[model samples]
Target: MKQMTTIGWREWASLPDWGIVIRAKADTGAKSSAIDCSSIEELAGDRVRFTLRLSLKSNETLTLETPIAMRKHVRSSTGHGHDRIFVETTLELGGAEKKILVSLTCRKRMNHRMLLGREALAGSFLVDSSVDHWATPRVKKALK
Candidate 1:
């Protein structure tokens, strides 16, 4: 059996298409991974559209329009939480890449910007609450 590598409680992550990098809190308390999003809409066919507003530890802002390949209703941290829409995307960390299923939601009230939940970190990263960004190096967006 293959062994999974571990990660710290917090790390710097990049949303490539969004042109932003944000400090992500690895929350084992959270069941599903979530990203801060706004202007969500259901497009024709199997696509979902939304604008991703990002903030890094540096407090830089970047807005991106992303077309989601899939969307599904998912449960949340609280009991019987809002039905969120999931998007299939690649999360690159610690020089390792994996395709992760992330749920999109309006996180206007949240502080950290992005939350990497248990499901997303499972079997891939082991979190140490005492540390921050010990695994993945901060990656910036590609200029297109």
Candidate 2:
């Protein structure tokens, strides 16, 4: 079996393909990982475009377009079912790198830029709610 790393409720993640290092919160309640994005536009050829909010503390944003991996109907914490667009991206977390499906949504009020859900954590990480920031992002620094 592959050794799994234990992470805290909060940590950092590097999306090397997007050239962004953002803050992430580990949430067992979520079924899939998510990123804060806005102005989502579904395009032809199964592609979707959106703007990623680089960090909670920074006003920086990046507009990107990528092929849609899948479309999923997800229930928010508020219990509203919404269709979420997912795109495959390289996620570097806790010294492990893998392709993970990340959902895009407008998380303007969320505390973290990214929310790491069960699907992203299942085999790679074990989360400890009592601790925070147990693992740092693979990148040197995050956008502030």
Candidate 3:
């Protein structure tokens, strides 16, 4: 078995077939991972749909609409949390990739839209708080 490795602040990731580059924050404090999304729309059944966009200061914005495979109750940052739709997908970081379950939430307000929590980082990475953005930074979407 490959021993899990540690990662710093920023890391490289792709949505597998989505062909989108996403930067995630390595946060052990969180239980589950979270991603930035917009145009959230609830579909029939437990599935939810939304657009994943790349937000960077320099590049033009790139957006893609995707749907959640499942939804479940998840604890929020606040002591009191509720059930939220969770999306299951592979998260690629630092040339390492793993299947991760992320909760669907609006992270537009945060500097880093994506956050990799313990559930996703467990046995995969060791976090170093002293350093920032150990992985190469990805340029934002190129405007057409």
Count of steric clashes across candidates, in order: 2, 0, 2
Which candidate, 2 or 3, would have the higher TM-score against the true structure?
A: 2
User: lDDT per prediction?
Assistant: 0.68, 0.87, 0.69
In candidate 3 the C-alpha lDDT for residue 89 amounts to: 84
> Which residue ranges in model 3 land beyond 4 Å of their true spot?
56-67, 137-144
Let me know the TM-score candidate 3 reaches against the reference structure: 0.78
Tens-digit lDDT track of model 2 for 5-26: 8888988887899987787889
TM-scores for all predictions: 0.77, 0.93, 0.78
Better model by TM-score: candidate 1 vs candidate 2: 2
- Per residue, candidate 3 scores C-alpha lDDT tens digits across 1-144 of 776655676666666865666777787878888877677778766567676646644333435444676667777666767666677888776677888888777776777767888899887777777766564454545211
- Find the 10 residues in a row with the least total lDDT in model 3: 135-144
What is the TM-score of candidate 1? 0.77
The 10-residue segment with the lowest total lDDT in model 1: 56-65
Deviation from native of the Cα of residue 112 in model 1, angstroms = 1.5
lDDT for 42 in candidate 1 is 72
Q: After superposition, how far is residue 81 of candidate 1 from its true place, in Å?
A: 1.8
Better structure of 1 and 3 per lDDT: 3
Which residue pairs in candidate 1 collide?
Answer: 6-126, 7-126
